[model samples]
Target: MTTIVFLHAHPDDESTQTSGAMARASAEGDRVVVVYATNGDHGDAPEDLADGETVVHRRRVEAEASAQATGTQQIVWLGYADSGMSGWDQNDAEDALHGADVDVVAKQLAAVLDEEDADVLVGYDWHGNYGHPDHVKVHHVAHRAAELAARRPRLLESTMNRTRMAADRQARLDRGEKVDWDPSAPMDDGNPLGSTEEEISWEVDVSPYLEQRRAAVRAHESQGDTAWMRSMPDEEFATMFGAEYYIEPGRTEPIEKGWPFRPPD
Candidate 1:
């Protein structure tokens, strides 16, 4: 069985970005584990949570539902505090994990990888799925831990394809829908490492897992409109957005030129 470990910045990051892939992998009998680097305490609290109540407990419950939706076998938390976005007023707060030591983070993650005997390691590209500081830190630590492992698992960085994103954004705009489109965004350039689409090493057919993906997305009640997302036709959702895209680290392998996770020959 292929054991895949996903390193995420917070509770909902896994569901938002890669839950479909996780569901697909789990359905295929792969051992899929999710590692969240932070408790997401900085995120919005549920309506039922008291104003002064921390998000830690609620986020864990949300994460558990998400894990169940994705058929994840294990959910691990590194217990770090969420470091809000880079430019946010609290970005420089003394308690933030933003400036946490890279080596220390790497060591903690390495222990999890070793314990799981993971064959593949997945995390956000340097852009952190939308340039969140915590997301970037998770990516950094994932790479560093992979480097320190005696038996390094294949490293995969999740990203968006610029071309696909452009086409999709335009399609939405053509529908007269309000679209927050930024064409020249540095992160939208399709390369997490400043590389090219030709550098992508893998694609998984997560179309079958779309429902589970949407469910996982809804699990992040703090973000996204579940009802709005559900209103879209199933085919439209699958075609316009991929659950995730990945690039292999240290791989000079010619892009497979096709999805990489098709059943083995």
Candidate 2:
């Protein structure tokens, strides 16, 4: 069985960004593993947090539930603190993911790749999809880890299709629906969200796994950021998240519908 590892910036990130693909991989009998770079300590705490229970503990539990919902075979944590968004003072904390030594973290990740004999290593784009500090670090660490991995796994960068997102936003507006997410709007790093469609290498259709993706996202109930997704209509969610995009670094071929384990047509 092909082993695929998805390296994410935080606990809930995999749910939104890669859960559909994870579900699809697992359903097809491949081993799917998710690695979180941080404990997501910076996430908002829910009102129902147990006495003496920290957000970190709660998030860890939630992440496990998310993995279960996505049918992931295993979960790994790099054991770093969550660095708050860009420019936050916590970003400089010694234990924060954003401040961790890239080489050190990469080595830790490389060990996992070696142990898993990972055939595919999925990470974020160079801009971290939206330029969050921890995410940007993930981009660096993932590349370095791939280089250090004994198996030299094929690396794929998960990202959004900005061109398509922008088009969808306009289409929503035309339909008299209010759109809150604008692909062209500047994000944490002052760059727009996602790469253009022309910059993408593959579009993996995961429409059949949408329900699993939704369940995964719903698992992270403590995170307010994903609340909207939990309440979104099935059809709308399918329209917005039915496909996952990736950029295969140094790939010069035209973009096509493909999965990491499949050969190009």
Candidate 3:
């Protein structure tokens, strides 16, 4: 069976970004592993956190639940602290993922790749899809790790479909619905959210696994940011997340419906 490793920035990121792929992989009898760069210690703290319960502790539990929901066979963490957002003071912390040495982190991740004998390594696109500092670091680390692995795995950078996202936003506007973030506008690191259609290599259809994806997202209940996602209607959720995007660097072909571990027809 093929082994696919998904590298993510935080506890809930896998849910929104790659959980569908993970669920699909698991259903196909492949091994799925998720490696989180941080414990998400800097994310929103839940009001229900018990006295003395650390944000890291709460998020760790949630991450485990998320992995279970996604049918992930194993979970690994690099043990770094969250770097907050791009300009936040936490970015300067010694243990912050954003500040960690890329080579050092890459070696650690490469060790996992070697151990898993991974067939494919999935990470975020450059600019980290929306330019979150830790996410960007993850992109760098994932690439470097693949280079360092004893057996190099096919690397796929996960991303959002900017073209489709914009179309969806325009559709919402046409419906007279309020829309917040614009895909075409500058985001955290000054780049627009996701990559344009021409830049993306694959549009992975994950509609068949939306239920597991939804469950994985719900598992991160401690993260207030995902609340709206969890509350979305099934059809709306499918419309928004049924397809995951990726950029396979060096692939000079039209975008197609397929995933990292499989070949496109």
Candidate 1, residues 75-186, lDDT tens digits: the string is 9988888888667765676656677898998888889888988788887777665667887787899899998776688888876655556666788889999987554365
Question: Best to worst by lDDT, what's the order?
Answer: 2, 3, 1
Model 3: per-residue Cα lDDT over 1-265, one tens digit each = 8899999999999999999999999999999999999989988988998999998999889888988888899999999999999899999999999999999999999999999998899999999998999999999999999999998998999999999999989999999999997999999989999999999999899999999999999999988888999999988999998999999988989898866675222
Any runs in candidate 3 off by more than 4 Å, and if so which?
262-265
- What C-alpha lDDT do the candidate models reach, one value each? 0.75, 0.92, 0.92
Clashing pairs in 3: none
Model 1, which residues run further than 4 Å from truth? 50-53, 171-178, 186-196, 224-233, 253-265
Q: How close is each model in CA RMSD to the real structure?
A: 3.6, 1.5, 1.6
Give the candidate order by descending TM-score: 2, 3, 1
What is the lDDT, from 0 to 100, of the residue 212 in candidate 3? Answer: 94
- Cα error of candidate 1 at position 66, Å: 0.5
Worst 10 residues of 1 by lDDT: 187-196
- Candidate 2 residue runs with Cα over 4 Å from true position: 262-265
